[model samples]
Target chain A: MSQLKRVQQWATFARVWHIYDAAWQNPFQSAELLKKYLMGMHKPIYHPMNDCGDHVIVINTADVALPGDEWKKRVYFHHTGYPGGASWTLAWELHKKNPTMVMKKAVYNSMDRSLQRRYTMERLHLYPDANVPLNLLENVSNQIKQLRPKPKRLDEYKEEEVREFPKLIDLPKSYIVE
Target chain B: MVFTSVVNYVRARGPDEIWRKRRIFKLAAHFIGRRRNCYSIALRNVHRALAYATKGRKLKRADMANLWETRVRAGCEQHNISYETFREGLARTDILLNRKTLADLACWEPYSFKALTDIAKRRALDDGLAGIKADTSIDRIITRGTLHRDK
Candidate 1:
């Protein structure tokens, strides 16, 4: 056998995807999902030193919800150099002030702190509502799965689907409408 | 309530006189030049600045994109993979990583980048015969999520 080692060719690249904000799910979890994209951890080409993450465009920031009392209890603090400059802004209060900042911060802080964090942040585009410009929306190629299932509206069920459901028992003629 | 033409009191927007008259000047405030203060010059200056802003944005995007492509290309070179081969392999494998993110990974995460190169190399070899068709854009190129045999 020859002493020389095999030298194969070809390089790998990262994949990016988009995420949308829905009121029903956890933004924190979604932030990690964003991080996964940014780090390119989801792909076989992912390396710890590589920034193979994808762009995440989030919309509907106005409707993002926090569990239980995070809205009231959570506080973002800021201090100016002047006396009594220290002040606190609650989560909901901050959200009211700038709807996009809440999810943006969550996604930002979720990643491992490094110089590239800001670069990853640049790829994250947040919008307050569903009214995204056509140009921006057109670039989105994929989506991350949501933690919570979207609840279906009553009227969303098709007539055929309702009819197809097997009935366990038939109501007697004396059945009264509740 | 009766209106008169003489000595009309304009409801000043704020306490500062300069600020009150800053309707057109506010547009020039962002510009760093003597023209920002000079009213006649500021008028034309603001118009020019607004026009340039649109063009500047497009140029800036192109500039950054070029830099990112350069970075990704350099990263591929380091791993002994040609940029063309790497890009083609990735596209065939359905990996849609944009240049910015790829360059980022190239700079910050060398090991991850190496792993990516390794995969691309393997996939490139399997490129011709194994035409594994997956429709979704988010389909995992590496993971053999589905099993099918040639009939």
Candidate 2:
């Protein structure tokens, strides 16, 4: 191959690093999105036997949002291989113990049960907050957009902006101040 | 040469026997143990391997087609468009590009693929196709269908 063609080949096979902000994003939905990058399904050269997967750096996993009451309702099961050693941990409880565990498990379960699952998981780096190592952060050239927009909290709005908001009815002068 | 007795005739083997066994042996040359050297075992393994090869040919095509679709879908996702919508938009606009070619463009010529997606997005929005977000701005795009309608 010519020098240009060889370089093109290398570019095509090169593994890319992507960064994702998991704050207020659904872990389950994010997992489905991240799984594509982790398994290299986003690449044209992807194959079951080929190692074309990319690295994904997820930050702010502790702030991930679960729809409805999943945080209280979802249960993670584990067994110690001994009789009566089974345990079930609620999603909220697990998150409190390890902030990144919920997001990590979500991505882990999203992928197919294959021999490469562990190796693929190794490429995923999750941080409880946006404090990633400088080395890893520098490697990220792309950003995976969140599945849904992060909802703005009422507290996040400035007092001036909130006070000027339109109202359908004027408050009565006799209305008691809480 | 005619055999003098019925027993001699029964014992005589055809000259093609060696060639027939050699063909099976040739296919089983890569096989291990008795399966490679023993004619009976080699023949059975060789037949199975040939059957797999015949089936594998069709499977390879299907696998490639699936891979192309995956690549194209991934490309579409990057631009915030669904694969079905992208294909539908392109079809409606008469782009006529196949999955293999679209996949090749997506991997090799990313800019070209992006342009294709932009065109598809415009076409999809113009037609108000389902599944489209309707958030994309199509002010600058001018498709053949749009030109005909404008005139």
Candidate 3:
């Protein structure tokens, strides 16, 4: 069998390095946000020169539910270097057509565009289907799960508990309707 | 430091003594979970540490695609067609352009995007003959059975 077929057909991908647990729920940081999340500056092992990270494989991109209007508002753009060479697309369309590529591209772009970035990217494998070949993940089944915390109800916090933001003072007279 | 202490404790007790007791790790985790200040933070940190150690790679493609679609929708709106209508028109017209490629063209080549949109618009305008609504969303089309059934 072909290597691609073998990899695809395996019930699990063993020693697959790392796979994102479906249970993990958190908004991903932008380029700047990643620094804090990884504790880049604070870690003892911090080195400006090295990619001190492990391999990660993401599965189930189609079902990666987001919290709010992020899915509706976020815009992705690519330039092909021509007059009017700016193509943009919404996220929902890409997810429907190609789930794996959507995620792989995001992670790749989020990382520093360097040789180390390419190296880390090599470790990432994206599969759109929920039933990822079991062999790749066979040894790590105990560690993988989908355990998102139930979203806390805002009503439970009540009106007083919510922090009030500073009032806006520069309201445009034309924009104000009666 | 904690790892060394745990290792020393196991060594002092003998390997078999530690191996026989499976709940030791769980007990340690539970103890850590109960601490009011530093220990509770340490427990959560340790849990995340373990997760990062074991969790799989995630590229966050869904987020990326959403970002792309938003860009596309904004561009489509500039052309006076809502993204919902544009997508519906494309589906009805049987246009093979995927959003990624469409977004790519829309960003790089406005003329080409305009041409493609023209095709969709023409198809949408011809909806009476095609028997599909030109100005609707994919959900409505699917739900209303306007999508071509393979009967």
Best by TM-score: 2
Clashing pairs in 2: none
Please identify which of the two predictions, 1 or 3, would achieve the higher lDDT against the true structure.
1
- What is the C-alpha lDDT profile of model 3 across B1-151, one tens digit per residue? 2465676766675556445343344434444433323444545665665676454234346545654575566456446565766777778767777777777776666667766665565556545434334543322223122334323
lDDT of 1 by residue, B13-106 (tens): 4467666448659988877777788887888888888899989999989977866776776677656666777877777668889888888888
Candidate 2: C-alpha lDDT: 0.91
Regions of model 3 farther than 4 Å from truth: A1-16, A23-48, A138-147, A150-178, B1-151
Q: Each prediction's TM-score against the native?
A: 0.45, 0.76, 0.33
lDDT of candidate 1 over A57-173, digit per residue (tens): 787777787989999998888899899999999999899999988888888889778888888788888888888888878877776667688687757999988888799988886
Q: Give the candidate order by descending DockQ.
A: 2, 1, 3
Q: Which lDDT value does model 2 have at B83?
A: 96
Task: Give candidate 2 misplaced runs (Cα > 4 Å).
Answer: A1-11, A82-86, A170-178, B1-27, B32-58, B78-81, B109-115, B130-142
**All candidates' lDDT scores?**
0.72, 0.91, 0.53
Candidate 2 local lDDT, A6-65, one digit each (tens): 998898889999999999999999999999999999876677788999999999999999
Ranking by TM-score: 2, 1, 3
Error of 2 at B49 (Å): 4.8
For candidate 1 chain A, the 10 contiguous residues with the lowest summed lDDT are: A1-10
The candidate that achieves the highest lDDT relative to the unseen native structure: 2
